[model samples]
Target chain A: MTTSDSSPTVRTPLYNLHVELGAKMVPFAGYDMPVSYPLGVLGEHNHTREKAGLFDVSHMGQAYLTGPDHDTCAAALEALVPGAVLTLGKGRIRYTQLLNSDGGIIDDLMVTRLVDDEDDGRLFLVVNAGCKHGDYAHIAAHLPAGIHLEPIEDRALVALQGPGAAEMFATICPEASEMGFMTAIRTDINGVDCWISRCGYTGEDGYEISVPEPQAEEFARLLLAHEAVEAIGLGARDSLRLESGLCLYGHDIDTTTSPVEADLMFSIAKRRREEGGFPGYGRVRSEIENGPKRIRVGIVPQTRAPAREGTEIQSNGETVGVITSGGFGPTYGGPIAMGYVSPEFSSPGCEVDLIVRGKTMPAKIAAMPFVEQRYYRKPKV
Target chain B: MSNIKYTEDHEYIRVDGDIATVGITDFAQSQLGDVVFVELPEVGASFEQGEDAAVVESVKAASEIYAPVSGEIVEVNTALEDEPTGVNSDPMGNGWFMKIKLSKASELDELMDEDAYKALVASQS
Candidate 1:
C-alpha cells in the first residue's frame, strides 16, 4: 500500500484523537487519514452496520454559493450541474454531479439549500476531498460576478451513521429527529453550532454534522461517548459505502464516466432535463432518451476470492469491463464489487469472469446495494 | 522442541529431521489484518526456495507466501479453507499452513534464528 511519505500530508481537526484511539494512518486524498482502528476492518464494518459509527469526514470540501436571491445563486449553480437547483426547496438537499462539456462527470456532490428569512441566496455544497480544489476553481470561474463561492475552511464535518444514529442524536438535539431525509437544519449540539443534514453515503438513516474546526474534536467525543457509538476509520467507511452501492468520486464516477452511464439519472430533475441548459445538456439529454452504451452494475464473485480495483471483467473470454470498487463485504459474508459493463452484460444474473492475479474467477451481475438501504423517510400525514 | 528458522518475508519453519512445518509469523498476520481466505499449494508439489508456494487473502488485500527452502509439499492445511482467521488467532500453532519434505536439510543454514529475525523485524519497523 501507498504511504504518506512522499509529500507533506494534511491533517483534520481530529488527527490527535485518531492517534490516541490507535488508528492506522494512511494517505488518502492528500490527507493522512485513518484506514482502520484496533478493531480491524472487519470488526469496525460489522459494528457500523449493527450500531452507530462516528466518522471524521473533515477531509471533504465544504463551501457556500451566495447571491442576492435564491434564484440568482441557484441559477448560477444550475449552469454548472444538471440538477434543478432553482427549484430546490428551502432546507432540502439534492445529490448532483458537476459535468464536463462532454457530459462526463467532474465530481459528484451534495448541495443543500438553507432556510433564510432574509432571502439572501446561499447554498451549501460538499465535494470530494481529492477534487475539492478543482471543483472550487471550476465554480469560481463559471459563476457570475455578483455571486460568490466561499470555501468553508474553518469547519469540520463528522457523520454519525448506522441504525441507532437517529436515537443517539435525538438525545442531544431533539429537533434532529424531526428532520426528514435529504433535509438539513442549523442546530446546536451541546452548545456547539452545527449544520446537521439527515443523509449519509452508507444507505442508512444518519446525520452529517458540519461543525466549527475548533469544536470538532469535542463534538465528536460527545457523540462517541454514547453506548451505541464507535469511532470508525476510512477502511470501514469504504466497505459500508460499497455495500450501499454508492460511487466513490474518483474511482466509480470520474471524468471518463457520464452521469447517465454511472446510473445517476435520477439526480437530473425533470425541469432540468426538459429545459436543457446545463454544461453537458446535449450529450446528457441524448443519453437519457436513448440509454448509455455502458452502465455501472454490481458484481458478486461466485467464489471467496475478492476482485479488487483494476481487475479486468470478462465474458466468455472477451474483456467486457473492469472492476472499479470492490472488497469483502463483512455483512454479506462474501466478496462484492461494482464495475462498468456493456449494456448486453449489465442485467442482473449475467455471468462473467473477474481476472484476478492471472486467474479467472466466476462472478455474476447483481442488482446494486448488495445490502438493503434503510433511510428514514417520515411517513406522509 | 524442533529447530526453528525464519525468512525475511516473515514466514517461519520448524524442522524435525527432513520434515518441516511452515506458517506466517504473528507480525505478518497482524499486518494482514483478519485473514479471510488461504490458497495452499497441493501436496506433492515441489518448489524452490523463495518461490511462491501459497496465497493468503485478508479483507483489504492478498499476499503471496514464499517457500523458505527448496521442498516438496507433503500436507496442506484444509481447515484454513473454512476458518482462515485461525491464521490471525494462532499463527504459529493451529495456523500452521503446511508441511514439507526438505529437499536439502543444509538449506536451514542460510535462514535466520529467532534472535537475528527479531533484530531484522525491529530494524524494518
Candidate 2:
C-alpha cells in the first residue's frame, strides 16, 4: 500500500487550512479528508455532540436539475425516483432514494425545491461522496431532453452540526435561526454568497452551507474561529449518522435494497404511494402494501464488544441477516449498529445474536436514533 | 524503572527475571489513534515468538498484537478490557498490555534496546 502523496491528494480549496490545523489526512471517497484533527475521533465525536463540529464535506456531490417549469422538472425527477417530488414545498428538502428499474436503491439523496426560484424549475440535490460519479452518470442518461443536469464540482459543502450550531450560525446569518428543519435559504454568509440549509446527517440542530469553492478556505476559517466550532472527520461522521438512525449509501441502502426494505416509507408521500407512477413504482408499491421480506433495523449489543459491518446475524442457530453498519456510538455511550434482518425478527424487542469472531454475542432489535434526534424547528406562535 | 526492548512489529517488551511485561511503543499508539478495545490473551495460553497474541482495536481499524518473545501468558491487563484508550494515554506505564513468563531469557538479545529502538523509529518516520 502506498502512503498518500500530501501534495497530490486532490486538494480541495481548504486543503492547506486542514493541514495548518493539524488534521490527520486520510484518503476517502477519492479525496484526502481530515479523519480527525489533533483532538482525535473521540474528542471530535464528543465535540460535535456537546458544541459544534465543522465538517469539510466538499467531496460530496451537489447538483442542479433544470427544466422548463416546476411540473416539468418534478416529472423528470419522479421518473427516476420513488418519492413525490411535486409535493415538496419551496424551501423544503426531502430525503429520497434513486432507484434502478429492478427496485434496488441506486443512492439515497436529498432533493430540495429551490427556495426562491421554484418557478424557473431547478431542484437542488446533495448526493453521497462515494456514489456521486455513478449517480451523475445515472441521472444524465435518464433525464429528459429539455432537462439538464449540472454537477456543481466547484462548490464546497460544510456541515456545522451540534446543539450550539444554530446559535453559532445566528451570529453570522440571523435569518438562519428562523429556518426550520428541512428548510433552506440561498443568501450571503459572512459577506460571501452561499446557501444555508437547516439539515445535517448528525441529527443535531445544525446547518449545511454550500459555498463557492474559491471561498471555502475563508468560510471554514471563519467557522473554526468560533469558540464552539471544531473540525470533524469521516470517522465521526459515520458514528454520528449511525446513532441518528440515518441510512448511508453503499451500506444501509444499496443497489440490492429497496426503500421499503430500508424502512424509509416515511419519505414516500401519501399521494405517491397511493398513485404510483415513479420509477420502480410497481415493485415498491407492492412491497409497501405487502410488507418487505427483510427490513432494516437497529441492533444493540448485549456485550461491550461491537458487531461491525458484515457480522452475521442469527436466530435460534439459523442465519437470518447481515449487519450493514455497526460500531461504538460515542454519543450513546455504547455500541450501536444497523442491519437488515428477516421481517419475522424485525420488531424493536426481538432478540438475535451477532457472530463476532465466531462467538455468538447477544443483541436486541431496538428502535432507531439509538439516541433522540435534536433537529431545530419553528416555534408555534 | 525497567529497560525496554523493541520488537520488529512495534511492540515493546521489558523483561525482569522470568516475568516480562508487554506494551506498544509511543510511536505505535500514535499511529493507531484512540484505541477503543483490546482483546488480551487468556492467562496460561502458550505462544511462540512472533505469534499473534492479543488484538488491539482502534476506531478506524483492528490490528494484531504479536508476541515479542515466546512465553506462557502469565497475567493479561484486565483494565484494558474497559479502557483501551489507556494504550494511547499512557502506553508505557498503566497501558501495558500483558505479562508473560519467558521461556527463554536469550530472546531479549534479539530485540532492540532504547538507543537502537529510538534510531529505528526515527529512520522509519
Candidate 3:
C-alpha cells in the first residue's frame, strides 16, 4: 500500500515488465514489488506446481567473500554461521543461518563456493533482502585481514521453479537440468553470462539465476517466452514456501528463535554443533542438547478459515503459542499453517485451536510439508 | 434493484420491501482477487450497523465483511459453501451473502446511493 506522502519505493530492473504484465505492485522490504499478476495468486500457485513459474527475486542480496585461499574464506564464514563451511566443496551450496552470540539467527542464507580452479578463494552468497545490509556489515566486521566481503550491486536474481522448470531451463542451459540439487554453475543463456544454482525455495526442482543488471529485462523476457513458464508474484511465493514449510526470514525465524526451535537443526553442521565456535553457538548447542521449550510445527485448521500470522494458538483452553504463517493452501484444498507450540503438542495429529476473529477454531498439528516436495535428486548407484 | 445502495466498506444492499439482500460489491470482489472460502452469519442473528457480520477469504488473506445497516439475518446463502468462487463470478447475484430483515428501515437512508458509492470508489482508486 502507498500514500501520497509516503517515501518513494525503489524499483527493480523488472518493474516496467511487471507493469506491462498487469502486476499488482505493493511495497515490500523497501522496494516496489509485484504481489500478483493477471493470473492471480491461486492460479499462480497451482501453475507453479503443475508447470513452471518465473519469479523476480532480484531484491535479494548477492555478494562475494574472497580471501587468500579457500580455507581463509571458509574460516571467516565459519565464524559467523553455524554451517560447516570449511568442508564445503567448490560449486557445492550450504544452507545456514548467520547467528548472534546467543545462537539466535541473524539471517538464513545460501553460501556457495566458486568452482573454477582459479576462483577457489571466492565464495558466492545470497542473503535476504531485508537483512542484507546488516548481514554484510556483520560479516565484514567479523572478517580478519586477507578476507573481504564485497556486495554485488549490479545483478538481478530470478527463480524458475516447478516440474516443468527442467525443460524450460534445458532450452537455454542444458547443463542446468543435469545438475543435482544445491549445486551452482556459471553459465550463459543467449550469450548473457549467468550464475545459476540448481535450488529454489518452492520445494520443487528449479534454478535461481543471477544475471547482470543490464540484461535482467532481456533475460526475463527470454525465459517468459517458454511455454511452460508464467510470471509468478510475491503472493504465490509466500504461499508456495508456506506449503513447503519453509521459513520466511522475519516471520518464522528472527533474533528470538533459534534453529533447533524452528526445526532447522539440520542447518547446523554436526562438527560445528560439537566444537561450537560460531556466534550464538552456546544457545544453539544447549538447545540442541536440552531441547527448545517450543518447537515449530505445521498446523492444519479443520475449517475453511485460516489463522494468519500473529493469530493466537491455544491448547486445552490455555494460550500455548502463536501462528507464524497461515493461509489457504491452493494445492492442499484447505487452510494450512505453521507455528510454534509447546514441545508436547508438536507431534503430528495433536489437536489444538487457532484463534481467528475471536473464535477458537479447531486445528491439529500436522507433519509438513502440506504437500510432498519434488526436488530432483539423481539416483545413486 | 432501484433501491440498491452501498456501504463505504463495499457491501451492497438491494432493498425488496423490508427484506434486504446483502453482498460485497463487484469492485470489492475484484480487489480481493480469488475467493477461496466464506463465513456467513446464521439466520436470526442480529447485527448493529458497521458490526462484523461475515468473512470472505481470498487466497492471500481473510477479510471481514461488515454489515451495512442494523438488521436481523433472515436467510444465509448455502451455495457459497460448495462454490465459493461465486463471490468472484457473480458477487451481486448468486453470490449474495445474506438477507437481512431491517430492524430500523431508516438506517438505509444513511447508506450511499449508486452515484455516491461510485464517486467514493472513484476517489479511492
**Top of the candidates by DockQ:** 3
Clashing residue pairs in candidate 1, if any?
A: none
Give TM-score values for chain A, per-prediction: 0.98, 0.96, 0.98
DockQ of each: 0.72, 0.61, 0.83
Query: Per-residue alpha-carbon lDDT of model 3 for A1-381, expressed as tens digits?
Result: 111235687799999999999999987877888999999999999999999999999989999999999998999999998898999998999999999987788999999998798889899999998889999999999999999999999999999999999988898888887788899999878889899999999988999999999999999999999989999999999889999999999889988998899999888777998998888877887888888988999999998887888999998889998999888888988899999998988889999989898998999999999989999897797
lDDT of 3 at A65: 97
lDDT of 3 by residue, B1-125 (tens): 34899998989999999999999999999889899889999998999988999999998778888888889999999899878999999999999999999998999989999999999999987
TM-score for each of the candidates: 0.96, 0.95, 0.97
TM-score of 2: 0.95
Top TM-score model: 3
| Separate clash counts for every candidate | 0, 0, 3
Better of 2 and 3 by lDDT: 3
- The lDDT per prediction is 0.91, 0.88, 0.91
Question: How well does candidate 3 match the true structure in TM-score terms?
Answer: 0.97
Ranking by lDDT: 1, 3, 2
lDDT of 1 at A82: 91
Q: Where is model 1 chain B poorest over a 10-residue stretch in terms of lDDT? A: B30-39
